[model samples]
Target: MKKLLLAAALMLAAATARAEDNVVKVNAPPESAVAGETAPAKASTIDCADTLGVSRVAEVDTAGGGEYGEQYPPKPLLEKGEVVLTFDDGPHPEFTRQILDALAAQCTKATFFHVGRMLKEFPDVARQVQAEGHTVGTHTHTHRNLGGASMGQAEQQIESAINIAEATLPNGVAPFFRFPYLSDPQRVRDYLAKRNIAVFGIDVDSFDWRWRKPEKVMHNVLSGLDKTGRGIILFHDIHGSTAKAIPALLAELKARGYKVVHLVPKSRIETVAVAEPTAAPAPRRRARRHRRSKR
Candidate 1:
């Protein structure tokens, strides 16, 4: 009877240990969870050189060029079969790393327009972006729409963003700016122009901010690109949906024979012009606006 009870107890202990091991395996974070994927997807690789070619270009100088606010797309619009990948409002701890992993796997480079506060909060993530050979730009300090802010408020937003980005990024900040909500006032445009900074306007808006699902975000981006052929594609890395959609997006870009153009500012933009009080542009169609879902 003693031998029988001892054997049963040992068996029960072994089973309990196995159950605990199984629990740990299931509860631990996944290695393949990058890009917000809950499970590992089939691995694939892309050679950007063979799939999407890269090019170097100077910033578009829009000073008094009448292409100031909503009209600014990269001058000499990207040629057919070419696309510029840019992300705004990022350095998100979860999604940014996933996006970076996807970009790295594809061996592609992109520009990240980070909010100042986000950058400060995730300095290591910002450094990771730089370490991955991607360009870093500012999207204002708090992401407040500069169009409505007072000149003092607007200057503080832009200047503080630049200062924070420069302090955090080893490569310093790139000379490119994107208006939050695509709300660019002529006053802000002129300020950037005077400092020789380039203002970015999107040709293809991902609208990922609206659709949080990866499949839907992928479809929206591809459909937008289909209409425009090639230009700057706006995405926000802060969105987990965007990160989840990127691998599929890159795959589709390869399938469609689209090329990725990586834009690097000719040099770092460090100067800030004295704020000049000027009128903001009258409300025009918001260039960065995306379709709102009724549901």
Candidate 2:
């Protein structure tokens, strides 16, 4: 009887240990505290069934800058449960930082598309995003809807955005671009192709912009995922709702067996030497003269 009782206790302990593997626990350091680390901790080291961290990184070669997304062809070959996290229209002052905190809490890495004006306004915040080792890309100089703009204006918008982002980021910009408002004209699409910049489209739109509440954002994402299964998921770092939505969304993703895929460019995007138009030529000359007099 003693020998049988000891064997039963051993089995119970083993079962308990096995069950604990599925319990998701989050213990993340503050974003400011993780600067010294090379990259976010790889969740692959932990059992896939256990952690809500990055599952794998997909290195993409932006050769000829092919367009991709569920809406476009040659999607990133994700398995049924894998999803890529991408954010655009950042880096906002307050909300971007909050989103970063939530993402770090899960050890997840995401791709950020920074606007030129936003980059200039919050350069320090942009640098912090880079310091955290997330992939960086440009959206446009002003987040203008390119579909309505002249080809020259579109080119200028795209080029200026990349130039500003490359100059701001320590690592330079990736050869990745996403159309603002998902409005991609064939002419602009072909232009990006010529520049060797990959175009990204959305598989699932979180619509966090419309659904300002955390629960609404979460529902939209999970429901969309239910239909699409896997692809690139879009969020905006400028919204407080998105930051609030992320933690619970990540937890739900883990519970539902969804894995996060980090996307990296095989090479950096080559920027063209195009000068941005001066907003006020007279003011610029006056400022230069004032500085010269000071000198």
Candidate 3:
């Protein structure tokens, strides 16, 4: 009887060990499993040759709408050697598509500030930007220069842009705003603060709008980075020069040991209906110029 019990105990222990081994094999992660089903591809999977993938995503709390950029206070959004790519006035049918392809090739991400009218015209391109995991923000309707506009006009412009962007983007717009031409008036700034929309300024202006040549655009960007060390770099996706320069610029950045940081909003901005400025009352007609005309 003792011999039989001992053999029974040994068999049970062996079976338990085998079951544990099977569980590990079945449930182990892709990186560690010796035998198991293939794991699903990572959402952020990059091409095997892609080395300039986004180094990090900075999720920011934009409450109270503070300003950012080398031009604004509290330092830029990145550390030394880290760069944020931002484009403005975009969703151009041709140029924006080219830019998107370039970004995908490098597995990098960027922020695009889309003008409301442009988004309305080429909404598919704008959706592509969102689908590819880039951040979308408002650049105001018609790209109006807020500095010259009345406070009411400025608010309308800002709100209209936000509303349009929210309407167009699948995930809605980020709590980010860039003043057209970076023209931030105090009242507009205060209004943005009240709305909780964080402002984005530039550290390095690619000046692609001025430099039609891709090489020249790349050179200016590199020189700007050389000067500023690291910060948000601005480009315009509407410009063919930028579309052409993107691939080489990303490669050059990677070669120079610069890491790309993607900026994501911690919260979505609660948008409101766009307001229209009240029209001035029509002047009352003069009682009569009839007597003067008769004389």
Candidate 4:
């Protein structure tokens, strides 16, 4: 009977092994991609390339007056009722420095969702960001909009960016990821889950893409910051207008007694041993293999 119990436990352990052994199957797109998405694929079947465990707790109206949506109790955006401000599509040599200077002057830290290509070109800036006591994250290599992209394309974009980030950062490091163009497809979120990366969709967006006026940008930014008690704030680092507006808006936030807290999502590692470092030596180099060979 003891042997039988041991065998059963062993089977359960083996079943749990694959969940943690996910080594980011980026070169290979998930099997669902082969199913030919004649229609929008659902999130349930999309194998999470890496899972990002974000416990963003906010009140959402669900027939009832309000309900809590956080998977776990979340960190309030600020220690003292501040906002979590995040910027993406950056590592731009000049603009990033400018934003950094502004935050530094205010004695605040912010999270910069960095792009891989930009980091490769402006590695110095990436280092400076880290030095500034701010969080650094992956914004993917090509910034491909994952909303309508194939699983393969999305995987490549995400994986290559991570590879670049790991190369850019120190050892024993994995950076958080945010999708490009605010890709919020449920499948995209799931894909990140499989890979142990978090999905960060904004609770408030300034919609800077629609227009470029600095005042207009501030207005929109202020609107979101005012409404949202907490969660991620999205802004573009790719635009000159956004750069121009950020300082002014940050100043406004200060006047209104808002503090900025740099935000990073919680991961599975916090709860269970979702992943264990493989001491297994990597296999020697060989030709790239893909189930669905790309052109």
Candidate 5:
């Protein structure tokens, strides 16, 4: 009887340990576990099981410029109907939260390239972004026209913006960047490459900044997608119209069978030596400004 009781006790202990392991697997890793970790397991926050039609694709980190200027899609490239959602120039007090809520409702994740100054002013919003499992990156200190600025000015804009973002984020910033107005200078491109930071350019511009009507903004985005097939789609969270359009836009994507791809840097960016000086490229015609209001 003593032998039998001892064996039963051992079995019970084994079962309890297995149960504990299962619990840990279901829960997110502790905060300490995420520190310095590049690819921690993400807890599923959205349930797409019932035809909302969302699916998460593999995490991708892209570098190098592409044929359409410095803008390039993900390295492995997206399949037909795959879309990577990206928002820029925000942490707008009114709209960022609304956008976040809409995204959470759909269990969708996006990459936000924030202006450094905005992150500093809205640290809570920035933290909320990271806490909810979206990738965050810098968009320059003041949303300055880096392509037209001197090398020193451009470097300051890039470096300071990154510093501010890193300081504000609980999880480290993703090693990704997007140029303001989609303008990237060759010299700036070289600097980012050496530091292992990837520069992002949009395949589809929602023109949400220019279009205040939600219906019109939604139409522009879907039309652009129709043209491009698949790539990163850009919007500005600062715009009330864009925030208002998100839910309808998400539904349209779902109805059209589009999948969302969440991007995470495969490796953290390493510190590098000072950037080399390269002659500034010839000035090009400045694009009409959407960020002027903030500046």
Candidate 6:
């Protein structure tokens, strides 16, 4: 009876361990005597079954009949110790500089989605980003509303920017492309898939669009970041306000106890545009909530 009980106990232990291994672990924010923070979450915070969509650590079935082949998706998050901060519409000389200074102080790496025109104008800042250990991606030749563009138009916008970025960047390599607006269609996804580029999308947006007021954007970001620590957090690095906001942003990020990680894809540079369609071009017009189908 004792031997039989021992065998059953071992079986239970094995099952529990397997269940634990399957859970997706999210990095918890650091705790401080500081006010307004969520304590670090445990592996138990993840509903392992549902988060396969966002798993960066596990071996995901890659494109083709192989494993995580030559081209794989960006690391979803650091293994319970990563935070990916992504900036878009940048290389704005003033703002990008401030943003970089912020990262430099923390030794944190981030992904910057560069606009082609902006990159042309501020090649120095773009170079600085790579030099400082941040990843660079294309945000399109013109920040066109992809939802309003055709297939050829979309391809041109993306490919042209990639060419320009390749020419300007080190080694003539431009790896990832993000749609100007986070617009996704099956056709668009299929087109990119053919090239083995993963669509980089934002999991959270700070809505810093509202003001030049650093405090407002900073407040919005810090509060939201407390909950969503591991995935991409979007902020614009174009405007004067965002530029001014970076120092505080980085400071708050540190105070909150996030490991500022420079997010670079292990395989290829993956660019994602976090966007919703603007249905109408007219002022005060709203895009009908009509489901826009994708290829």
Candidate 3 lDDT over 1-295, as tens digits, reads 6674344333323322222232211111335423211111232221323457667666656668878876567643677898989999988999988887777666677899998888888999998787666789888887776666888778787888788888888788887898776777788898888888889888887878676899998998899999988988888998887898999999999999997877777667798887633342222222332111100
Please give, for residues 1-295, the per-residue lDDT of candidate 1 as tens digits: 6674344333323322222222111112334221210111122232234422233322332223223222564345456877878899988999998887776555566888898889988999998787655678788887777767877778877888888888887778876788887777888887777766667777777778777898988888789888878777888998888999998898788788886665555446674543322333333333343422110
Task: Name the TM-score of candidate 3.
Answer: 0.78
lDDT of 4 by residue, 36-132 (tens): 1011212232222222111121111111111111221352223334466677888888878777665544445566778767877888887766655
lDDT of 2 by residue, 1-295 (tens): 6674344333323322333233221122123121111233322322323446666655666667777786677543577888988899999999988887676556566889888889988998898787666788888787777666789878888898889888998878887898877777899999998998888887888887667899988998999999989878989999898998999899899889898776667667788867663441121112221122100
Tell me the TM-score of model 4. Answer: 0.61
Task: After superposing candidate 1 on the true structure, give the runs of residues whose Cα lies further than 4 Å from its correct spot.
Answer: 1-70, 271-295
* Candidate 1 Cα deviation (angstroms), residue 249: 0.5
Q: Candidate 6 residues 95-163, lDDT tens each?
A: 887776655444345678887777777888887676554568777666766666688766766776666
**Shift in Å, residue 47, candidate 2:** 11
Against the hidden reference, what TM-scores do the models get? Answer: 0.73, 0.78, 0.78, 0.61, 0.75, 0.65
Q: State the local distance difference test value for candidate 6.
A: 0.54
- Please give the lDDT score at residue 291 for candidate 6: 18
For model 1, name the residue pairs that clash.
none
Pairs of residues clashing in candidate 6: 109-262, 182-275, 187-295, 200-271, 200-272, 279-287
Candidates 5 and 6 compared by lDDT, better number: 5
Give one digit per residue, the lDDT tens place, for model 5 in 14-78. Answer: 32222222211101223323222122333333233432322443333333322221144344446
- Candidate 6, residue 285: the lDDT equals 20
Q: Model 5, stretches more than 4 Å misplaced? A: 1-47, 51-54, 62-75, 271-295
Clashes of each: 0, 0, 0, 18, 0, 6
